[model samples]
Target: MGENIDVVVIGGGYAGVMAANRLTRRDDVAVTVVNPRSVFVPRLRLHQLVGETHDAVVDYETVLAEGVRLVLDSATGIDAATRRVKLAEGGDIGYDYLVYATGSGSPSPRVPGAAEFGYPVATLEAARRLRSVLCDTPVSAPVTVVGAGPTGIETASELAERGRAVTLVCGGALGPYLHPRARRTARKYLARLGVSVIEGSDTTVTSVKRDAVELGDGRTVASQVTIWAAGFSVSGLAERSGLRADAAGRLLTDETLTSVDDERIVAAGDAAAPSDLPFRMGAYIAGCLGAHAADTVLSRIAGDEPAPVDLSFPAMCVSFGRRTAIFQLARKNDVAVPFYFTGAAGRKLKEFSCESSVEHLVNEARKPGSHHWPKAGKHRPVVLAAQRGESAAPAARDT
Candidate 1:
């Protein structure tokens, strides 16, 4: 018997939950997850919450391992030199190791009036606020959804399917991550839902106002409810703590998810920039990273070298309301291919993925070290080499 290792994981999103649960594998390690909310938020289904279709929250008891302690509070800063996490409320908690998995949120909008007038659905609180606002507004109100990313597309389509007049303002192409054919499919589906799909270089939102959104082309669209789904930004906790972070404020890490400056700290999910090249933000990747981060800590405790991250993307799925979706297949490198699944098939796959993301946490809670992900292909090394200005041969296939 020896002193138990205390590992504190900040944030209880997909990544944090997975990391906490997986860390419970060792009897000698104690895991504590710090989250602001008491319940787990199913972020992918947040649009459903705004549409009044789903609540988008799960009890922490259902997903968190019984051995893992759940701390209901936000982390304000990290005192890495003292190995302590400062809580927003008052005291700090010391940790032998720390997992920096604060996830992400809507960036502080810089567009004029956007911060004051626009509604973002990136967090549970934000989604609930938007849901309440939508409930109070008339169904006929014109809802303008900014950004053409998956969140924007889902929100617009969800509202439109609920009989609300919705306009999706895509600064550029719709579903920029999708193949051209897949993008066409998404556009067609949006049109079918009676959603006005606005696209093109000139369609960028210049400013958001109380009653309308101005466009780069000098056009103004009437908007009773303005939803900003443009993108996500990580918290400044790491940067505020004086840790090396990427330009996006994600903590800089090595290939093994260890902090570049301190091996005692690791990062996961959207808050981690491994090798200064982060994976695309999603629950699938987040869960894998969380599990890998746990393994890295366990390896260090056992005096073994932690293995580098080896995960690859298989596809990207975006829902159009509840009945339809587009599952765009991609290579291991995450570049979309020409093929895709849509209609009923895509919807089923998309729903399964959403469910499985949470189920991964629950399963990991019940059986630590049970989750597994696909290994990264040869593309990452070649890309890294090119970034370093070293010549490299092309990979035979990404997957």
Candidate 2:
């Protein structure tokens, strides 16, 4: 056994990166991140697949703390009782602490052949697939996007800008988390870009076959390509490992973002569903939560009480294409209100969110004591190869 406890992190997304970057600030606790990938895939900018925003993929070697270790293996199961993670490979690694940040996967409703026929637009692999198809697929082709959340909106809008016949099928109000004004404004902006958004009391998608979507009201729309942009489903890692999970399979966390059953085992990003807040995972929250998770681990190692994590919702930018967009201002209790800004202004806000996430990671990695950033490593992909490739793109403009 090592003098300091080994902190094993699962999944290498925004939450895992932030957690790992913050956690290793102290010299006491050892950190190990197990993930299948090495690069910090910036998912928010993934909608650019319809466009040309490939510059968003981040390299983790520059952001991780000096001593943090990265392992490239797929985590198959978690043993909470023994504090050991069962890997798909031949080894079993034990951890003094565990952080579950497996994040979400593409959710498919029981809608006919949607699972088999639908083209995914969320995960990195899915985006890559979509990119390959889009680059080969003809412009003005019929692309059906289901779901009206942030991901759906970005995907549909960006696709429409490319002159594709985009039909966004929303089950409920568009951007339910966004304020009513913003929702209306978003609807209008989407329409302006030639996106046919179907939303009404009876508008619903019951099933989606390879060529068409069966609506709830017995209406059928031709969909050459269908994209599922529905809600997020927490990874099965925590659920299979016997950890306490809510209805959505997210690990139950306390106010400090650590698992309720185990103090050493914390959660971050989308995979962490704090019993108190029960967040609807986003990068804005993941980055902050990741930092806090790291801080808590470091404080424990220092024999000090970890600080409480308090996250409040503000506005988030929604890109409506390269030309049009909406700047939503979300209040404490309500959804984001529409600021009615588009073009460069809304794009600037979107860019700000990206910068804010990356900057927080860089600063917290350099200064561990400033604010609590947890040390969690979940992605063991290609980043461990030590490629210090700097961003060729301009510094993402801040808000």
lDDT of 2 by residue, 53-145 (tens): 554577787667778888888888887788888888768789987878788878766777888888777788888887887788778668999
RMSD of 1: 3.4
> Would you estimate the TM-scores of all the predictions?
0.97, 0.88
lDDT of 2: 0.75
- Candidate 1 residues lying further than 4 Å off, grouped into runs, are 391-399
The candidate maximizing TM-score is: 1
lDDT of 1 by residue, 247-300 (tens): 999999988899988989999999999888899999999999999999999999
For model 1 the local lDDT of residue 157 reads 96
lDDT values of the candidates? 0.93, 0.75
Clashing pairs in 1: none
Superposed on all Cα atoms, the candidates' RMSDs to the truth, in angstroms, are 3.4, 10.5
lDDT of 2 at 64: 70
